[model samples]
Target: MDFYHESVLLKETIESLNIKEDGIYLDGTVGGGGHSSEILKKLGQKGLLIGLDQDIAAINKSQETLSQISDNYKLFKTNYENFEEVLDSLNIEKIDGFLLDLGVSSFQFDKGDRGFSYKVDAKLDMRMNQDSSFSAYDIVNGYSKEEISKILWDYADEKWANRIAEFIVNARKTKKITTTFELVEIIKNAIPASARRKKGHPAKKTFQALRIETNNEINILRNTLDRMIDRLRPQGRICVISFHSLEDRIVKDTFRYKFLDCICPKEAPVCVCDKEREINIITRKPITPSEEELKNNNRSHSAKLRVAEKI
Candidate 1:
């Protein structure tokens, strides 16, 4: 399927980056090159834009779209979790700016075959990278009931996690839960009818949790944020667009810790820890999409853009 992702907080992110004409920039999640195209437009011929994405479709689509902008652009077909390795392989020492738009792209969801959406009745496959061995199919059919419960509760914050996990375990005992519809039915059966009537979809949270676990999305984002910060040059900015609260929490906490001057308790007489501040939080609060953006694209409603400048 053709790659497509609505760039959430596009103008806010671009402005937050404060793009320099000759600066080096990186879009760690270059889905469809939407933001990259804008960043490149603000750059001079000497400037560079490094793009990374695990999805082959994103890589191909972004490459094709970004090619027209400048040869100064480079695309990496790798997870954003490996941002340091990506930079090292390219002989890039310090990045002037970087951006990460976390979570699955619109293409992954809307493209019927990828199976990222519970709304679709496709096969249960949610591997961001096609080469990855683990998929939603494996998790549903192979994982223990306890593990499934933990995944849904922790990742999705679903109140019916335990019931859903029990239902899945029971259903799979008869036959492997191999399709989206099968899993959706299991989720519907698990959730209380009264509660299901209030929310958007019964399967939404469970499916989200499974996809996150399958891709190691939360852990990867948590681990990579600090390392990515380290690779930035002083005054350089890192802009992250997070779709969910889990991803946003990581970005928010990381930014706070990096920008904090003191690690000591308030009762302490003198500062002991010699931790130096690495960044200044550019967005005191994450910048959400404007009303117009939301009206035009419903996908941007949950999106939040957080930026921090290296100190």
Candidate 2:
């Protein structure tokens, strides 16, 4: 799986970790072991790296990739949101650093049979975890028009959400919308010919909405960010690379909230509630890929890396 994924912002993410030679690190999304291999290389034999990914294919590939580097890494087939469970099972209470590359790997998009890309005419199965009972097919064929529209609007801010939902609901009555290309056609048809001329694929936003809903991506990130941060040792860093505005906003706001000592109104002279600053924001602004990185990987175009250190 050498060609499975390309690590984005590799150098920057490692640097943000401030990896100690004997430090323990967590790579929450070990897609093809790109980031985990690098993290392991920076470690001494005693410096263990625990990795997680919901995709079993990723776990197997990561095993192969990191084995060539060293046996210091252990990968599990699970989502980063379940890091606590994995850590608890391993008796690992604290980690020196955490790296969460929030972008869906290029491999998922490139694998036509997995049904992640609208350009691919394959089954509507965008489950990052192959074992997931839910898939894009269920969302498209089973959801009410209002529910589908809400997902598109809330997840990707698709302006044509209502029209697309209407189209999907109407079309599915005749036969199940069972493939990427089938949904693409519906999305294109829902859009006016003039609106279809917009930049990017007509199905891009709709597909994004479905994938996210199928995986519950946004909700997982929102619910789990702080729990992971709380497990970091003092001075331990957490570096998160997000691919879009929604995820970036969560990272930004969470970091901002953690950096604040008091939530009392600015006009209040005294600190009333018990609140202390928990972390120091390392990136005043999220780090964007360099021009070279952007050129090398178009998927990195929207990538933003934000980091914070536990106090």
Specify the highest-lDDT model's number.
2
Q: Residue pairs in steric clash, candidate 1?
A: none
Q: What is the C-alpha lDDT profile of model 2 across 223-271, one tens digit per residue?
A: 9899988999999999999987899999999999999999998898999
Residue-level lDDT for 150 in candidate 1: 99
Q: Estimate candidate 1's alpha-carbon lDDT, on a 0 to 1 scale.
A: 0.90
Q: Could you give candidate 1's per-residue lDDT for residues 1-311 as a string of tens digits?
A: 67888788888999999999999999988989999999998999889999998998999999899889778888989998887887888898998998988857889998888889988889999999999988999999999999999999889899998899999999998999988988999889988899899848888899899899999999998888999899899999999998888889999999999988899999999999988889989889889888899999988888989999998
Q: What is the alpha-carbon RMSD of candidate 2 to the true structure?
A: 1.2
TM-score of each: 0.97, 0.97
Error of 1 at 78 (Å): 0.3
